[model samples]
Target: MTITHRFLQIAAVAMLLGGCTSKPIYNAQENFSSNMGISENQMQRAIVTALHDRQWKIQSVKPGQIEAEITVRGRHHAEVDIPYSPTSFEIRYRSSWGLDYKNGEIHGNYNRWVNRLRDNVLKELSIDPNIEALNNLGAVKRDVESPSYFAFQEGVERATQAGLLDGSIQFYLSGQPVPGSAHHIRTVTSSRKTNGANKSDKDACIWALQSALVALQSAAKKAGANAVIDIASIDQRSLYKDANNYQCNAGTFMASVALRGELVTLK
Candidate 1:
């Protein structure tokens, strides 16, 4: 081949490889403003709820700041730090693992997550008055008349009495038994609902899990067990109607969820 032709061919190959390998500049910080006429507290709650909907574990929450961790498929993980005020918020990429790039460029999935999270937060911030009223009324009625309501309170009391309601319970989403343990106890469920306004499905889900855990603790105390396992959300049903179920639903103004799990004693 001629020298000129060979040089051109090598340059073309290099260009193609560079184009293929080039990474998009990572947007480390995503800024958002609330023009939906919601208060700062409401906005923060919505953000937290959005994170919860995405299964992000909240590490810490301050007046205007939140730190959360996202785990994808039990392998890939990332940390997001959100700082907010009455009018603005920022979703900042803190750190990541199992992603291809380090700082300048981030994996596409990370961007996608932050974007999706922003969308969800915005949705939660949007307000609807009629729906809010209905949700509030429903919540009030449930508190006054729902058998599950009383059961939940009773469970909380029992758990408190037994000193098992502390956030020390080991929770497993998968229905897997703890290693080196082999004793079965009864399954327990709990459910909770959130007032539609200023709350998101994520917030409701977190509350539902807390209620469910209290119920689980109550059941464990009754069964004389030490731990609960395979904690998970379940569909709302008549069987779970009296027990708070951990199935989260979000509407114009309110959010709700039901949770279920098995109480067990670890060996």
Candidate 2:
């Protein structure tokens, strides 16, 4: 539909004609509210309840693709300055897939399962105030598939919708959680080199730092992190103890915290 779709299609075809194969893009889908997963009605209820339970009055829920931020909540009515001032809530849901080529065909698999899972991962208002549920939109770390599927959906959005994927399309969504939200927002970035996946130099060190810098920048903006240290912060002695002999045509991206905005808070 857009220039991107056209470009990607062209690129995929070009690679195929060159006797190369590209990863087929998996499709992410959002099932109706009546599906087995959490319904929009239920999600809406959960969001509203989460806000109300936390003393954050519900303002509105915009279900559109264009809005930069999705859901918007307001403080208590007492905090209302205008007819609709600062929303007390902001929730957004997006899903996408990677482009994969199999048998000379692009595969667009439906990823609604993740959408369902995401809907079910509602805020745990019951958690203690000290404990917070920090779910990064892009912070996907997992040994799992469903959640990873969801992350793929979001990644596609970044590439297609958010315009983050200008280079080759990547298969991300580790489906694991880093450690804490306070550390930073979850972001995945990659870079590839020749020499066949060496664990020593550029593939391990310089290239890693380059990718990390990109990830850090992306995380900062996407996660709204407060600040980030120099790429040197990632102890060169550790992060990439092995970089030489980088994977030939093999790409690697290190996930890191992005931003530290005051987005997540207990009710």
Poorest 10 consecutive residues of model 1 by lDDT? 236-245
**Which residue segments of model 1 deviate by more than 4 Å?**
1-36, 127-267
Q: Write the per-residue lDDT of candidate 2 for residues 225-264, one digit (tens) a residue.
A: 5433211111111121111111111122222221111222
Per-prediction tally of clashes: 12, 48
lDDT per residue, candidate 1, 1-267, as tens digits? Answer: 999999999999986765554355334333333322347787689888998998889999999899998989987888888888766677887888876554467567778887778767755644222323444666422443322222343444455566657744545443343665747776565555556566544454445445556666666778877776655543322122222322345554455555556677777
Highest-TM-score candidate: 1
| Total clashes for model 2 | 48
Give candidate 1's error at residue 242 in angstroms. Answer: 45
Q: What TM-score would each prediction reach against the true structure?
A: 0.38, 0.19
Residue 152 error for model 1, in Å? 45
